[model samples]
Every structure is written in structure tokens, then in C-alpha cells.
Target chain A: DTAVSQTPKYLVTQMGNDKSIKCEQNLGHDTMYWYKQDSKKFLKIMFSYNNKELIINETVPNRFSPKSPDKAHLNLHINSLELGDSAVYFCASSEVRGGAKDRGSEQYFGPGTRLTVT
Target chain B: DQQVKQNSPSLSVQEGRISILNCDYTNSMFDYFLWYKKYPAEGPTFLISISSIKDKNEDGRFTVFLNKSAKHLSLHIVPSQPGDSAVYFCAASDLGNYGQNFVFGPGTRLSVLP
Candidate 1:
């Protein structure tokens, strides 16, 4: 059983195009996150949502927006996609203990969505 | 600045040998650390983790050691098998910093050859 899943494993689009990637987690986790892995293979967090509430926004570009319709789903939408946005986007989820967000909780990740903006 | 760093890009080890992967961090506030392993076309999965209070945590053949003073940690896999080959990522998190938590390092690919 897949704990977390993302659609469109491979995405190829031209510059200035708008696209969206869908992610869903079945692990019943309260926190969901969006991460972008650049060509340098550096994975950085873009957004995090806890129980349908935005908790972390990592200063990502304004064009990139993350929407969490529910606790189990977090979707990423990019407008006017630029060549620099070509990279693998990962979706992850975790259950954070209340009043102890500092503790490390194992994050379950989905098979990344590879976006290529030509 | 990059808080977590895995200097080694890749490492190779023979079957039944020991494979050690090292990670360093610059952030002194980071109190929690984790190790994740990923295979091709797959997402990273949690392997092990250690807190600042403990120096070592072991699970089966995998062990993680943390040195808080040096701000360094290492993952050791004893009797590594061919299936153990994967990309290993080191991640660190700071207390009370929810937005900046979960800083990850560029992963190091490990190849366990038979």
C-alpha cells in the first residue's frame, strides 16, 4: 500500500505555462509538505500544512502556490513556470506530536513528480 | 546558508562489509536528526534518527551516531547487502522553528556491490 502518492510522475511543459500537481496521502497524517529538488539535487521545503492550516511557507516564489483542500491532500500549482522550475517536486506527510513540534517524526514521501519546463 | 551537508557524493562497499556515511551540520540549534534512504524512481524512506541527548541509536544492522559538540553524525551499516544500495539523505530539525525545520542535505548515493 502506498502511503503517499502523486500524480503525473513525469511532467513536460514549455516556459510560461501553468500546471498543477496533485498529491494525496493515506497515512492519516496531519501535516503535509511540498518540497522541490533542484538540478543540484538539493531538496528544500516549499510549504507545509498541518490539518488544513498553513504552517510553513519557505519564501518560495509567488508563482508557486500550494493548496490543501483537506488534511489528506496538498496540491501544488505553478503559474508562469520558468525554466528554473524544472526539477523534481516531492510531497511528504508526517504526524507531529502536539506541543512537541521539535521532535523528529518520520516523514513519508511520495514518488516525486519530475517537472521539465523547457 | 546550507545547514546540513553530506560531503561525499557517493560511496561503494562490498557485501558483508561496513559502510559508513557521514553528515555535518552548521546550525547549533538543530537538536533532531534523521537518515532517509531512497531508491531509483522511489521516494525517500525513513531509516533511523537520533536526538541531541543521545549519542547512539541502533536498529538491527543499522546504527546512527551523533556528536553534538562537533555538530556531526554518521550512519553505519554493518554486513551491508546488495539491496542496501540507495541514496542516503541527512536531515536536521530545530526546536520551535516550524518554518525552518527539516533542513536536508544533498544525498550521498551508496552502492553495495556483491
Candidate 2:
């Protein structure tokens, strides 16, 4: 079974269009995160949700919004997508909010969604 | 500023040889360090990790070493295989921040040749 999964493995859209990427985790984790990997392969956290509560919001553009309907799902919605937004977006999940002594805090990653904004 | 850095952009090693990837961090509050492996079109997978209090942690063929005083860490793979070719990422987190803020290095690509 897939521990973590994201919809739209590949996305191509025009600039100024709105798009959404959905993610789900079956690991029963309490925290889920959204990360963007640029062409340079630099992975940076964009948003983090713990038990459906927004926790970490990086300096991402206001056009980017993340909504968590439950502990198992976190969806990212981007408005007015820009060409600079062309990159891979990843969804991750962990068991706890804080550092777990056993490193069970390790984030389980999805296969990643490659978004291309024209 | 980039808090975590992997100075070497790429490294090549022969199969059956040892592979060592180095990483450095400037944030003193980072209490946990981890190494991840990634292939093209896939997200990173956790490999190993070491706590600030411990200098070394080993798991089978992979070993992670942390030098708290030097603010450095390294991942060593024994008997490297061709399948080991992938990008490696070094990440650090401050436990005080609930581990929410993890800074990752740009990454180091390892090419293991037969």
C-alpha cells in the first residue's frame, strides 16, 4: 500500500490560472507538510499542518494556500500560477509534531507532483 | 542564508568502494541531522540520522557521523553499489522548534560506477 500519495503526478497549465494538488497519507500521521523542489533540486518547506492546524508557513507567495481537512489530507491551491512556480511539489507526513526520540519523526514522502506553469 | 551546505555538487565512486558525503551546518540550535537519498522524479527517502549528543550512528551498510563541535556531519556507505547512484540531501532541525523548521542542503549527487 502507498504510505503517502499525491494527485496529478504531472501538471501543466498557463500562467494566471488556478490549480490544486491533493495529497493523502495512510500512515496515520498527525502532521503533514508541503514542499517545493526547484529546478536546482533544492527542497524547501512551504507549509506544515499539525492535526489540521497550520503550524509553519514559509515565506511563500500569498497566492499559495494550503488547506487540511483532516489529519490525513493536506491540499495545496495556487492562484495565478507563475512561471517561476514550475517545479516539483512534494507531500510528506510524520507521526508527531515535536521531535520523537526514536526519529519516528522522519517524514514519509510521496512520489511528488511535477507542476509546470507556462 | 543557507543554513545547511553540501559543498560537493557531485561525487563519483567505483562499485564495491566506499562513498563518503560531507555536510556542514551553521545553525548552532540544530539538534538533529539526517541524510536522504533521492532519484530522478521521486521525492527524498530518509537514509540515516544522528543526534547532536551522539557522534556516530550506524545501520547496516550506512553510517552517519556527527561532529557537534565542528558543526559538521558525514554519511558513509560501505561497498557502494551502482544502485546507490542518487542525490543525497543533508537536513538539520532544531528540536526546540518542534522539528517543524528543517533546513536542507542543495544536495550532492553520487555516481557509483561499475
Candidate 3:
């Protein structure tokens, strides 16, 4: 069984269009994240949700919003996508423990969603 | 600012040879480091990791060495095979923070020549 999974492996849309990427994890992890990899292969974290609550929100554009219906699912919604939004979007999940340092909790990533805004 | 950085954009190595990938970090608060490997059209997979308390960690043919003083770390793959040819990324996290936010570096593409 796949530990982490994302839907719509590939997304192609015209500029100014809006879209959403769905992510699900069967690992029963409490933390989920969204990352964007640009053409230069630079990966950056966009958002993170812990226990269905928004935790980390990097200085991303207002158009990009993340919604987590439950601890097992986190979806990214992009409004008025631009050409610059073309990139590979990755979904990852990690297990977190309170008090004790969770340094060894390795993140498991999904296959990724390649978004192309023409 | 890019907290984690991989200076070498790409590297080539002969099959069965040792492949070393380097990473540097500027944040002293980052106490844990991880290495991930990614193939074309796929998300990166976790390979290995190391804690600040330990300078070295090994798993099978993969090993990671951390230099806290220099703020540098490296991933070594022994007897690298063609199947190991992929982009490798280094990530770091602040142990003090419960958020577990990871900072990743620009990946280094490894080409294993047969």
C-alpha cells in the first residue's frame, strides 16, 4: 500500500485558471506538507498542516490556499494560476510526537503533481 | 535566503565507484539532517538521516557524515550502480521546533556511467 499519495499526477491549465491538488496519507501520520519544486530543482515548502490545523504557512502568494478536511487529507487550492506556477507539487507526511524530540521521523513523499500553466 | 545548499549541481561517477554528495547549512539551530533520492517524474524518497549528537550514520551502502563545526554534511554511496543514478537532496530541520519544518537544498544530479 502506498504510504503517501496525491491525485492528478499531471495538471495542465491555461493562465488565470484555478485548480486544486488533493493529497492523502495512509500512514496515519499527524503532519502533512506541500512543497513546490521549480525548474531549477529548488524545493521549497509552501504549507503544512498538523492534526487538520494549519501550522506553517510560508510567505506564499495569497492565491495559494491549503485546506485539510481531516488529519489524513490535505488539499492545495490555487486561484488564478499564473505561468510561473508551473512546477512539480509534492505532498509529504511525517509523524510527530509531543515532548520527545521527533528527529528520526522521516518524511514520506508522494509521486508528485506536475502543474503546467500555459 | 537558501538555508541549505548543494554547491555541485551535478556529478558523474563510474559504476561500482564511490559517489559523494555534499551539503552545507547556515542555520545552527538545525539539529537533524536527512538525505533523499528522487528519480525522474517521482517525488523524492528518504534514504538516510543523522542527528546532531552523532557525526556519522550508515545504512547499507549509504552513509551520512555531519560536521557540526563546519556546518557541512555529506552523503556517500559505495559501489554506486546505474540504478542509483538520480537527483539527491539534503534537508535539515530545527530540533527545538516542534513544527518539524524541513529546509531542502537544490538537489545534485548523479550520473552513474556503466
The sequence of per-residue lDDT tens digits that candidate 2 reaches over residues B11-67 is 999999999999999999888888999999888999998777789999999999999
lDDT digits (tens) for residues A5-26 of candidate 2: 9999999999999999999999
List the candidate 1 regions with Cα displacement exceeding 4 Å.
A98-103, B98-100
- Give me the iRMSD of candidate 1, please: 2.6
As for DockQ, the candidate ahead, 1 or 2, is 2
What root-mean-square deviation over C-alphas does model 1 reach? Answer: 1.5
What's the TM-score of chain B for every model shown? 0.96, 0.98, 0.99
TM-score (chain B) of candidate 3: 0.99
**Distance from true location, Cα of A59 in model 3, Å:** 0.5
Q: Which stretches of candidate 2 lie over 4 Å from their true place?
A: A97-104
Per-candidate Cα lDDT values, in order, are 0.91, 0.91, 0.93
Q: Residue A74, candidate 3: how far off, in angstroms?
A: 0.3
Tell me the tens digit of each residue's lDDT in model 1 across B1-114.
788999999999999999999999999988888999999888889999888878999999999999999999999999999999999999998755554358999999999999
Put the candidates in DockQ order, highest first: 3, 2, 1
Query: What value of lDDT does candidate 1 attain over all alpha carbons?
Result: 0.91
Which pairs clash in the backbone of model 3?
A: none
